[model samples]
Target: MRLRRDHLIDLRPLTTSPAFARMWVGSTLAGLGGQLTIVAIMLHMYDLTASTFAVAMIAVAGLVPMIVAGLYGGMLADAFDRRRVALVAASITFASTAVLMILTWSGGETVAWLYAIAVVNSAANSVVMAARQAIVPRLIPRELLPAASALGGITMGIMVSVGPAAAGLLVAFTGYGWTYTIDLVLMSALFLGLWSLPSIRPEGAVVRPGLRSLADGWRFIRGAKNTRLQFILDIVAMTFGQPTALFPAIGAVLLGGGAITTGLLTAAIAVGAFFSSLFSGPIARYPLHGRGIERAIIAYGISIALFGAVLLAATFGLLAPDRIGEDSANIGLIALAAVALAGSGAADNVSSIYRNTMVQAAVPDAIRGRLQGLFIVVVAGGPRLGALYAGTLATVTALWFPPLLGGFVIVGLVALLVRLAPAFRAYDAARPTP
Candidate 1:
């Protein structure tokens, strides 16, 4: 097959808009810190309780507050200046991180303190993310939105790939206090991005931030079949296929690289996403976005199953497990698992590019904040739900069973949903319909 020339990332958004570049850089740095904290928190929980279910409860603890914050934050973004909204939300996150750092340093950090702080941090971040996502369209043109989304993937890619690995190393070598303190320091970078942005409010008929505004947003979702389908499909994919909560256990028990293994497994997905976004020119040019999303998600499910298979092999002693606190590496199985995760990451990033493009292109700015809020809730909250699923199911069964079975469930469900929603399957990027 002849290689396509337009497979490279487009840098126009970065070069054409200095403001976007600044925000992107600042967001990227802050996101990196955020990922560091996420991984660190998971590791910390596992250390404290030595139970996967306990670690999974971190997501459970934060889920409801995150959803509420996402909804209200979207309303705030629509009603107020998005930049200022983001700044305020970011300040909350920064303060929470600072408190976490202080607690860790004091050597008095308990599981309760961690969970409480994480819950607050998750809620605050929902607001920051809603405002940040809503502000993007105003910064760049509609046509460039896909490219911008690809750039956003790159941000996630770098953040997830580097941040987790760094957190693992930091926590493993320097201890938890230093790791949190580093995140606290890194969070300060977010201010640079928000500070440089000009005021951006909703451009059309404005709705006041309240229950009425939220109901209107929900009404829009009910009417927007394509947008709603994408959300549903994403939730299904994440709910079934995400195996993040299993990583710490996998690293410690099955895979055997301990913190390094956990970090590597988590980072593998980001590596795939980063590379896919790095070479997203073909994705940007694709017109039939719905089909693209469906195909990518199927591929994602397949990769997830493959990962489960690798884990199953390890369970069967087909691969060697590393000893605890030792440098013993299960090179073959780790490589296989990483390869599978990398495939899933690339597919998910492609799906996200199309889904994000659709929302930004088709959705009206009047209620874009709320829709994006819902989008954030789906995107961020789905994984938390997945954590609950994977954690609970794995606790009851085995790590490999959940993903192995869940992968097929994702493929079957997504195919069924597409069959039910012809409009969604027929969606075209060039002519967005929401």
Candidate 2:
């Protein structure tokens, strides 16, 4: 009930553990660098081929491979030492990035080469991500799960906010080579972070990596009523409601603000996440874990609806531009949408705290990595799928239409799902049985 600032902080698992703290520091920088490289790659690919579709394919090309990497990486984590798995994955990334930098600097600008290396980079990053996520619980107490997740939110907030912006400026001023070089340097920290940790072997029996393993994970998930429901619910919310892919169009047309609006909108969500984590560390220590998740998701839906309202208001011209400083591209509408977005970010952070704790606490350590790999697949792949949904709807309907519909659908769907899953509703925090 009483939400302390550290309650917010402690909501994340990484904050309570010193070792995780160090790892977070490294991962945060590396995450930012990775984002920089990602945006840079998109831009570079576009510059070479001048096809947005081709640029989109870069992610598509890597999608299956990334999923494979995540799944197989989980297998490796479960079967072998987590530290070694992470190190090997990180090494793959580091080496791939170095090659990217070399290619960029050597005046080789083949679109094919870009696509090839991008696949390598994305696949490696995905595996490294799965391995790192599985490694989190080993560093902290069970009570610190929320705190660790909050720390992850902070890391995500900063990296996602800062990385793209920096990459844009760097690419605009200097070149893509510089961006790739920065990534190479930043990736070194991940190696150190992972390499320094002691070997973290799985706590329970290990399964071989394949179809059987996937089936076992599914069986394990089926028995986990709360876990299964949460994942399904999240898939619904993320698949239907995620409108990040439509940001550029929202800014350019529906919102009528442009790239600055797009960038600001994206960054505002991250800012909210940063503050949410800052406040959530202690909030994570609440009495009602399951109910907390439900309330948070409902709040998230409300926030999303508010975002839709802002978009609709902009489209309808109810809010005057000149009065709200429309001269510099009507930042008033942008600010209003930002508030909604920020609220969404906060609510989502809260939900993440519960969801992550549920996943880590409910599952055994031996299966945690593999399960987390699947979780990573969900986490990583959801946005790309969202991109498809948003892009398709935006092309046919309107840019703002998807968000407008998405918000309402999320509210209705999540509410209904939460109601259906009574066990999740009764999930207790102190004796987390989810």
- Using lDDT as the measure, which candidate wins? 1
Residue 208 in model 1: lDDT: 91
Assess each prediction's global lDDT (C-alpha) against the native: 0.91, 0.75
Best by TM-score: 1
What's the lDDT for residue 191 in model 2? 73
Q: Kindly list the per-residue Cα lDDT of model 2 for residues 1-434, writing each as its tens digit.
A: 56343353653344456667777888988888887787777667756764445555676677788888888888777888888888888888888888889988999768888888888887787778777888887888877777778788888788766776677678767889999999878877877777777778888777777787777777887788887777776666676666665665565456654444555676677777788878774566775667787788777777877887787787777554643221245567778988888888777777777888788887888788877887777776765666566667767776667777877888888889889888788898777674
Listed in order, each prediction's TM-score against the native is 0.98, 0.88
Error of 1 at 302 (Å): 0.6
Once fitted onto the true fold, the runs of candidate 1 whose alpha carbons sit more than 4 angstroms away are 1-5, 321-326
RMSD of 1: 1.6
Error of 2 at 51 (Å): 6.6
Q: Give the Cα-based TM-score of candidate 1 against the true structure.
A: 0.98
